[model samples]
Target: MEIEGVRTDRLGLLLDQFDQAREMARVRLAGLGDDEYLWEPVPGCWSIRRRDEAVTPRAFGPGEWVLDKGAPDIPASEYAEVVRQAADGMTVAKIADDWSVGVERVEQVLAHTGPPEPDTSPVATIAWRLGHVHSNFEGQWEWTFGERKDPGLLVDFTPSAALALERFWASIDRWRDSVASVTEEQLDTVGFSRYPHSNDAECPYVTVLAGANLEFIHHMAETALLRDLWRTRFTTSG
Candidate 1:
């Protein structure tokens, strides 16, 4: 379809992809119970927890529950800078002063060996995956269609599977509506989506839509696999 001689085929394709992925996620998440949603197949899995029960170094959310993604690690480049500053006769305090960070952070950089040789990201539970999906859509919608406010670290991680499902589905619907409302010119316009969390500001709005669709597809598939594993865990253990 062409609107004022602007082709909307690409936009239609993106919307179709988004709808299909959303339906797949909906079916995969149907009948999810708290036991399966929060199931940790292995020790040290990341998931949603009550703010008081959170064990990760950094947990995010404004409510009683938080999503416990691990804390950010200081990059090796920063550690090298710390080493250079130390070699230049800068005390830890001086280094901290120059960097405008705390002395403990500077010390941590100096003491850091490196990130793990092999990536050791913990397995994420369904709750964590759903929260991530919801946040992505919510943030994208906010920056793209609604107010351009930064969503920041304020995630709404709920312990209830039903509420999580409802929130994510609503988020998807909002994102879909926003995409549908955009014109072809807007789709080709760069910086149409001012989502601060990602590089969407650099890419054309169509690229952002494609990327977001793929993100939903990728994470939802992972969630489905986790559900399958959860269902078979007892048999596998036996």
Candidate 2:
């Protein structure tokens, strides 16, 4: 069915670009080591570390389901930090290159990974950070493929962070197919998804999906930066 948006077929095109960006990011990060993967190039920059010694108050926030908050016009200092804070550094290589054989296996692995034992510094494997990053694209899948029963019903990982990742990723094909079937009318239909959304009686599905698209793009960008930092920091550490 034709999705109810700027155009019936435009959704696929839009998502294609999103997929492309994610794939590129994944390609770069596939073989990176954890130590290098966690490196942050900028001074005073945060990459995912434990709050050890409390020198800097490490902070992180979920960017899902939030209204655009909009972008800055001139890229001001404050605005740049806002953008940086909102971004979650992740590579596109899920499923195959990630933790397990299946998409859902990722969550299982994560679950096993367990939450930080407590008060540890924000390491690369931040408590909930990996899972949070994985879920960033979930809202889009739900909006395009199926509606999320509850936004809070985030996909959780188990058994060392593999559970959630594996489970969710296992269903990626299903998600892609589901999104392809979306109708434009359904996208614009208000109340189709949930509340606290821009389109109370509008095509929230499409809009959220659009946000997801942007998120996927962001993930790729983040991954690229992380991988680049990795290459720079340790590749030559002989």
C-alpha positional error of residue 1 in candidate 2 after TM-score superposition, expressed in Å: 12
User: How many Å off is the CA of 104 in candidate 2?
Assistant: 42
Q: Would you estimate the TM-scores of all the predictions? A: 0.75, 0.49
Model 1, 1-238: lDDT tens digits are: 8777644698888887778888888888899999999999889999999989998987777788988867554345456656876886879886676665688988877876756234456789999988987877888888888777657553578889998888778778877887898988999998998877665776689888888887899889999999998888768443
Residue 235: error of model 2 in Å? 7.7
lDDT of 2 by residue, 4-92 (tens): 55333667676676567656644654554544443445544333333231233323223221111111121222222222222433222
Specify the highest-lDDT model's number: 1
For all the candidates, what are their Cα RMSDs to the real structure? 7.8, 15.7
Model 2 Cα shift for residue 29 (angstroms): 3.0
- Against the true structure, whose TM-score is highest? 1
